[model samples]
Target: MSPLVLGPLVRCVEATSAAVWVETAAAARVEVRAGDATGEAATFAVHGHHYALVVVDGLPIGAATAYEVLVDGVPVWPEPGSPFPPPVLTTIDETEPLRLAFGSCRTSVPHDAAGNGSHGVDALRAYAMRMADLVPAEADPDGGAPRWPDLLLFLGDQVYADETTAEMRSFITARRDIDEPPWDELRDYEEYAELYRLAWSDPAIRWLLSTLPTAMIFDDHDIRDDWNTSLTWRRAMEATSWWHDRIVAGLASYWVHQHLGNLTATERALDPLWRRVLDHEGPEELDLSEAIDAFADRADQDPTSYRWSFVRDFGNQARLVVVDSRAARVLEPGRRSIIDDEEMAWLDEQVRGGFDHLLLGTSLPFLLASGLHHLEAFNEALAAGAWGDRAARFGERLRQGVDLEHWAAFQAGFAEVSRMVVETASGRRGPAPATVTFLSGDVHHSYVSEAQHSRARRRAGAPPLQSRIVQAVCSPIRNPLPRPVRFATAFLSYGVAGVLGRGVALLARAPRPILRWSYVRGPWYDNNLATLEVHDRDLRMWWARGVVDGDDHARPRLEQVADFSLDAPERSQRRRKRRAANRSGEAPSAFARRRSISST
Candidate 1:
């Protein structure tokens, strides 16, 4: 058997089971051993490539268990005499608060000085180093300090099929004729497999993957820039011969590699594709090439067929609903939406309250800068024929050219999700969550925004506000926007765009946004990773980036950019209730001091 090519990656973990994904140069039976619990699964073939998802079961809930990987009964991971720490599988605990790390947009390149200088430092790698340093040099009975997060959420753009680094370009050139229409971008399954290997093979990132239980969703760049952005773009792509194969390969590989590992055991058992593979009685690695490709084709052609979006209940403590903002879109001209009605119904079902916090992970921000939000809405209106025929044509060109394909661009879809959010926040769906926060990426910058509810929602006889709605965005774990492009984005998102967007909205007769918002944290354009912690009636978030000291680009240091904390809505309500109950003229400061002492 050939050696492991990509991972012993711990993908999705629950209270009792974990999915460890791996890829090898050839077909092999892979096993994951944790304590005495062992699970083995044979590698399946896709386009001549081999991969397996080893589901390790019967794990102790809420605790970390170290695991080792074996390829055909021979140890292959934590490779013999390796210096790095052993891989660990940590299951979720119902009783404990959740701490999650999330970000998106990364490019795979060398970690040397040249790579750093060209592409900026890698924030994820820097985070891995920090996690490693948390362990003590000497062994202790209690084992090294445990500061790992409960889970990690990758918002989108985990891999860039449309963009290529120098190394990627070289590989593509060596393998095929670069003069082809697609040029430096990826072509098919083999190229995508190579891209993933490059993206996940770095020692630090690999270690991070092997330990951190992760869930991911793909954005446009995962397949191509502005994928499924508009009807115009889709028509153009379909006109090309190679585009169909590229999309099929992209979605098929995504299912085999990323999506397959995300499902719970029960969910996997229910999957039609997996059910067929698992039921096979033969003692050979299953080949899912045709089935997976057909499924991908059907999924792309009909967004309602297979739901890419899913919801996870973290033991009733928190709820994570990751929405598919790209592929499951309704891009029918004049009725464009980020998600179709079926998807919207599913999302509505998931957005109900009752958990401490409700996290909506969308690749596109639900609430962009008020200015950008209005601009996208205005563009959508024009593209929908608000303007004259010639002007509408111009609007379509502008929307496709500038990549106006976010929630804001889909007025109906945005309003629907916003209404759901308002309903949940007002406790109409269920017991209101402390916060309804949207975690997002794909704009190439990081920021946090708080929603300002519409006047109508705050009118007389409205349900009392019980949950705070906010948007938190983190992007580009490694890739950086070029200086010129960064300036253009900033101006369009925050500056001149706002002033002109309003006028355009009036001209287009665009409806007023249901909820307006403003940035409270940042619009930082750095390669960074973000972490969110839910504890002590507060939700705190921090962003960090990798920085190189003078002349030491290879050994990048992780530096904190900014951190902000939001008061949990339930906490504020409690304070109000206390004030109402205490009729006496007790000073606010006195109550605060008393509450602080009691909390301690």
Candidate 2:
């Protein structure tokens, strides 16, 4: 067997440099060659697993070049008889429009009829096939072929450590006593390594990752369900013997597998841990098992010590700020927040307006469906003893039981971020962008919502809102909610839930949300992936799902689910006037032309 175990994933690409990551069967040097540029790095050991992140520089800006991977100086990638085209690394071009693909929540399973029947087809795989032109293109309902994405942003839940599949469970059973604490859920670094292998090993998806640059941040499932929902929850987990090992390993594995590649070469050079990797020159593989575990432990205990959130700029076109909403949370009672003070300050700095578009990627949606947002707010209030102590206990139970934790649940953090967004949109921070958009996943469903200052706040003489404040969510690139649960989710997230949530909030005396929003499209429950393209002053977005034809489950084709464009402010105002003149009560799906294909 080839020494390469998993990956060769292209990550964190800039105008002239890129990072390629790989896992090897044993300690060995990994090399990447693209055009005349070549980079190599020796494998680092973490709990017996070997990995390398080769930062290739000196490539011409805005150029595309096929790359080859070699392990121990022997060509190992573009595997013999591979069906996919040679993997290419394309550097960012400031002049070109930005195309980004994003989604979250995938479970690893066999790509066969049974797997598709159980979980749904892998939308990412279908997208990869479509990009590779392995699957014949059908007539797109929204005209023209889709442009290739400059980057793939995985919002969160790249692996479900808490929800193990049969394969993961089997591996667990073979390694340790399954009947022990934590059951079949992942326990340590080795389990995490295997889980990632299962998630990324599929041929088409593997090839796709090897070519396109990717950025990732973890959500709760990356550690465990509701990993740090509250101080009470944290205390309970700390009481358990297994939680320590589980957390240490989860975070340590994340650093090796996901977080390291999220950083730009410059950022990595500034990272002390990464500096250790670069400075090491010993003959044996530089073991990071103890050092990384210590770092993860410290990071979990004090999020202020290290930053997981990152910012990337697409020249003057766009700024992508991916926030770490899980580990950086302030979970103490009476002060619960999505992110602590230090993180919030960092985010405040990064969110300044200048680019044509401002994209904030959070694992949890910043603005959820109106009703659900209110519901979560009410829960937070009740849990904070807005009612009585008895009610607080009930509220805590309900919060954990139903997964009521989100940005809305952390009111202080939500309000602060809201202020920053409002300020940025109103041009107080800098030159306002055409749109301030939040890209998120974790809801298991997809939707689009537009936010505006509450009427009263607008009357309070807030600066004229210039940018379109919108939230677009795409989730479950593979894992779809069961049919029965989908009905309940829809009900709770739409009209009825909205009314109920507001009433509950009033009863609890919860602070009224500063902004009000309405759904522009969706609440669609499909295993899908979504993309955004910057078109001058306008931004276009669309969602697509994988559809298996006949029994060719392995060769699923991409089917469009929704397509819409957010128009420039002037165009949107005119369209609104036209709708009003026609006496249309229906909410317009987009600020511009829109198209959608109903779920089958």
lDDT of 1 by residue, 1-600 (tens): 347888988988989889999998788889899997899988888889888888989999887888899998888887777657788888888787777889998888888888887778999988887776655222211111236777788888888898887878888999999998788888889899888888888888888898888888999998998898788889999999789988998999888778887788888898999887788668777888888899999999998989778778876668999999999888887677889888888888889988888999998989887777788888888887887788778888988888888998988898889889988988899988888899999988889988857666556456666888999999889888889987776776665677687778877888776576777877889999888878745787888888888877655778888787878876777688777656676555676768968969
| CA displacement after TM-score superposition, residue 155 of candidate 1 (Å) | 1.2
Which candidate tops lDDT? 2
Assess candidate 1 and give its lDDT. 0.83
Q: Put down candidate 2 lDDT per residue, 339-447, tens digits, no spaces.
A: 9999999999999888999999999999988788888999999999989999999999999999999999999999999999999999999999999999999989999
Which segments of candidate 2 are over 4 A away from where they belong? Answer: 134-146, 574-600
Per-model TM against the reference: 0.94, 0.95
For candidate 2, give the lDDT. Answer: 0.90
Cα error, candidate 1, residue 247 (Å): 0.4
Runs in model 1 deviating more than 4 A are 136-146, 459-461, 492-499, 573-586, 595-600
Top-scoring candidate (TM-score)? 2
* Backbone atom clashes (below 3 Å) for every candidate: 0, 0
